[model samples]
Target: MNLILKLIAGIVAGILVGLYVPLTGVELLYTVKEIIGQLLTFTIPLIILFFIASGIAGLPKGSNHLLGKTVGFAYGSTIIAGTLAFMLVSAIIPLFDGGLTFNAEVATPLSNLINLKIPPLMDVMTALASAFIFGIGISQLQLETLKKVSDQGRDIIDALLAKVIIPALPFYIAGVFAEMTVAGTVFETLQTFGVVLVAALVMHWLWLSVLYISTGVLLKRNPIELIKNMLPAYFTALGTMSSAATIPISLRASKANDVQEDVANFSVPLCATIHLSGSTITIVTCAMAVMFLSPSMDVPSLVDMLPFIMMLGVVMIAAPGAPGGAVMSALGLLTSMLGFNDSAVALMIALYLAQDSFGTACNVTGDGVIALWVDRFSKKAGS
Candidate 1:
């Protein structure tokens, strides 16, 4: 909540500065944006590598059946949510403004005062491949030593995110807006993004309704009652802005839905880590908006976006436990798959962080659905 407030403050301050400040001041702001952008880019691969590797290696070896079912459900849910967002946003977003497009003519251009670049140790794909190879090998071979290393590496990256990246985000965003304001596009940008944010929130609830209704029909349960049971978890997650932090309430809610205790215990925690359908929806929606708004980028067709959504489900594994962690996990994909530039990525981070609490609430609530399904399947296998 503090982070969101701080981000709002940053946006307001940047806009004020851009309105009143001289060119040098705006240039200074752009410099800050540039440096922070470099640091964020450098961290993206490491976040993907360590987090995914540690998550995979840390899985409980004995619960293969439960784990496989849970992961499959989580991934399928995420992909479907992303796809749905892409289709809906593609159709509906155009109706909002008859399609918003950036006009580069009136834009005042600002450049970084200092040209600095920090490259990643490995590219996103390389980091992803290496993480999978080492993670699977460590898990299969019982390589405790490498597993410990991956865990430590994950901890290190988590710290950097919590301490550095999260804190720096407001200023990065402020700079982004300041540059836009100077270009005379900030007000239009804000108007369009306000619509985008509302659309994203609507999509979150829409997807949640889809999940519970599908689960209700399949399990022959009242979807409303199930949603009612999960409301406490949803509100808790909105406050905490964290799926992991809301797991306790989520477990209680799942159990209240008559999910078996053991399944709730296993699936709630695992879903907290892997089931990011809500976050995926927001990312896809925001990514599409960014593409539509950017002159340098083009909106992708559903076919072009499917592969990104598939890889996004994998990249989102064990996202760092911090505010905006899902977007942090997804930055690489936005850049690599969608060709998001620095400004596009910054807009994405800002737009995502603004409504992050809602997304987390959605994620936590949806975990109960996975728990119910997993419980039913586990019992069937036992019978």
Candidate 2:
């Protein structure tokens, strides 16, 4: 069966067990779940650092202008997505003023499992700064050995994704839902999450349409036909829910859309790492909806939130392409920077995971648009 199906089955089974399984006090499932969660978190910081650096180093030494344009445009698209989510969710939320409050109990023995953290020398923001310098610095200095090391680090991350992380995701998902069901918060909170999910999906479509319309005007191709070519990537991401996993497919789709080989290779993987428009939109929307509904929380004023939204846009660029990677990376910011209580953070996790596949579909699809844009711009610059 498909990986997505397996994951969905895990979710379904976990919810059922949580809701009906007579294993309420069972420590086995909870223990396993916490262990898996810790493992995934363990890989995130290093993976982000290495992946960003490797993607930077992957660009041709002579292609500094292309690199700048690619990064600039990718960051621009993400900003559009984050802002769009904020707008759409804010406008639509008054129509349904419903809220969710979660006072759920974490499963015991497993809840006792310690979070094994190996923090980076600096936090996420600092790590990205360091990565940018080292990644770009190595390329300019012609340090082939360090470049080789970055490539190896990227490979190790790839192995972790395929052999370890992806394989374990279903069980991890099951444990999450099961715990929620046991706590009796699943049904009510999911209702609020549903509203956030719909808003995020609509914003995703809007951003993709904007991307394709711009492509049509600049690149002089039928936007519909271009969108059609990208559908395969979108669908692949829908199933895998991992842009990193879908990179190979996304690259193939971009090539078929007539993106030049050099542009496709550098932009697809780099965009997969950096282009998290859909995920950011979904997170922002979900976080907002949850905040609106919770009595103890109020969605911060826009002026207060503007800096956060901007920082969040960049911070999420480091989000790995794993299933719950964006939220996992954003956890610290959500709690510390945004003042989300434990309950709010828990709600964010559920909401983010619920709609992650659609966000990923939007993300990989947008990569095609970015690739098309970069190709047109690079040609003009060269001319």
- Kindly report the root-mean-square deviation of model 2 from the true structure over all alpha carbons: 4.1
Give lDDT for model 2. 0.74
lDDT of 1 by residue, 331-354 (tens): 998889998877678788889999
Task: Please list the residue runs of candidate 2 whose C-alpha ends up more than 4 Å from where it truly belongs after superposition.
Answer: 1-3, 13-28, 99-122, 214-222, 236-270, 312-332, 339-354
* Global local distance difference test of model 1: 0.89
- State the C-alpha lDDT per candidate: 0.89, 0.74
- RMSD values, in order shown: 1.6, 4.1
lDDT of 2 by residue, 114-140 (tens): 454543444555556767888888878
